[model samples]
Target: MTGRPAPAVLPPSLRGWLGLVAAFAASVVAGLGIRYAGEGEPGRVDARIGAAVDGVGPPWRSVALAMDSLGEPVGAVPLVVAAVAGCLLLRRPRAAVFVVAGVGTAVGTATLLKHLVGRTIHGGNLSYPSGHTAFLTALALTVAMLAARRRGRGGLGLGGTAAALLVLAVALVAGAAMGWAQVALGAHYPTDVLGGWCTALAVIPATAWLVDRIADRLVDRMADAGRRGRR
Candidate 1:
């Protein structure tokens, strides 16, 4: 019988996972700082920031509304579905699963934490983590990760790396804009948004790792099947 093809190692290296862990740790620390701050300093800061945003000219109001809409369930859910469909069309079922699971977990975790923490500020209920921010950030990061993997396979050439970086930069910008828009609309505190982002930072890489493991197993099985057929 022909020998099986060796199992593949997932592309995102150990150091990459470490970086995500560090980011998650930092976000947890930041969330705790906001949570325990006497009289809610984070809430106060959020209010000031929101006021500043409100004062940033009339046209910006429209822009903020537009950005905020991107995070709304009506818009975000459909976009995520479309993205998953696109990934499936590209024959990356694992990537598509990652997108759905990452976003779902991020949003669900934020909701659970909000309820568990029971934080309220400025007459808002269960406002610790911004669900909208978490959803958008997770979606953006998933898209970037899928795009990078799709294009980064050939080689880590300068061109591929540059393209990946460009995609990441844009995704980050869009996520940040959406988060800030949440603050501008008085829907969530800045710390809430930060918590959402941190949650996504923790969830996305971990999800990717899980999906990669499953994909690796499937790939190994396929390779083994082909080897047997050849024999």
Candidate 2:
């Protein structure tokens, strides 16, 4: 008897899903902890950190200010749009969808959480989560995801893995730099930045999974149509 063909190993999506779930859980837990720590009072940590960060000299101030702008609409929107366009141009419709959904969800969630939690730091306007940090982080992550996906099928082996890691590291550094700017400018507390980062982490993978599911359906449909045509 002829041996059956070996089953093809599917690419791993479970790890991404699991990571998204864990991040969502962590974001919830951290938000609650921050709320509890404030306890209807202004956050002392916010005040202390704000003061320390503000004390730095002009050179650092210039850098912080530049990083802070990255989270603003003027800076962030273009980058996001360009990344999405690039993915579409490359025929990665799924990755493009993930970029829009992931970034949009992260920003929307941050806004919603701010309202729901109704907490503030030093009495300075809905400060539970930093919107600027959320936007910048989401943008950074989207770029990294697109880069990794683009290179994934190129058979670069270990080099591909290293390149992906490097992209992720750079994205993270950019996010952290923006977070520091927010903190230094006294625009948000450290916990607020943490919340934003966690939210992005949660949303990106969830969106990626959704997009992947849609893409799989499309591929299956096309394959079936091709088979029918051949008949």
Candidate 3:
């Protein structure tokens, strides 16, 4: 047929997007698992949940609270990536600006959810939609979107299979590690991370597509303006 590679299939579709939303809702339910399950006697889930709900303890407690501080690393990360993307743009390089924008979207969404959803921190804030969880999930999403964009580029042989596996691995690891860290530090009820991941998974794929359309239009407009200015 034509020489052009088959148009890359969008990795996620409408049904898939809805499924992701359902999954996030499921995560919210699952976050309560530690509350019911995780049998470590009566005080197990409660103790940890209480800790997170109450916020950090005294000075000593704060120092040891790496999980709570996971946001620090997450926040620091997008900055560097955004800067790199900016550099690429400066050089007229085809860098991924969507990835940076995606992080911003996650952050903005987290802020809105934190206030609007009225979910508490642990008790007062609810902590159902964790910022820590959102941050990690968003990072994984960036990797997955970038990988999907790269598909069918060189060839779809063994190399392609290996590459796909690698991309999935990266996304899973990043998402999972960040999620677990929050759980470990007792900063979020397990459900919070689950909801966070589910929400992110649902949103990122559509965003990737939307960013492409918007960027293309901006590029076209820029070219048109350049032509008129040269007249």
The per-candidate count of clashes, in order, stands at: 0, 0, 8
lDDT of 1 by residue, 75-169 (tens): 88799999889877766666678888888888888787777666676654667677888788778877765555433433232334554464457
lDDT of each: 0.66, 0.65, 0.53
Provide TM-scores for the models: 0.76, 0.76, 0.59
Write the residue-wise lDDT of candidate 3 on 1-231 in tens digits.
112212222333323443454466455544543343323222465457545544445663554365446467665575547644643544422225555666667756665655544445434544655676666666665645444344243323324345445544665676566666665555555556655665566455556566656656666777777788889
Candidate 2 residues lying further than 4 Å off, grouped into runs, are 1-21, 24-48, 55-57, 122-124, 149-168, 222-231
TM-score of 1: 0.76
Candidate 3, overall lDDT? 0.53
Candidate 1: which pairs clash? none
What would the TM-score be for candidate 2 when compared with the true structure? 0.76
Residues 1-231, candidate 2: write the lDDT tens digits: 122121111125234443644476466737665564444443677667667775457899888888877777887788888877876776656667777887888899889878777767556478767778878777776666555443343212324445456545755776688788888877777767877776776666666666666666667777777788889
> Which stretches of model 1 miss by more than 4 angstroms?
1-10, 13-18, 21-26, 33-44, 55-57, 150-168, 219-231
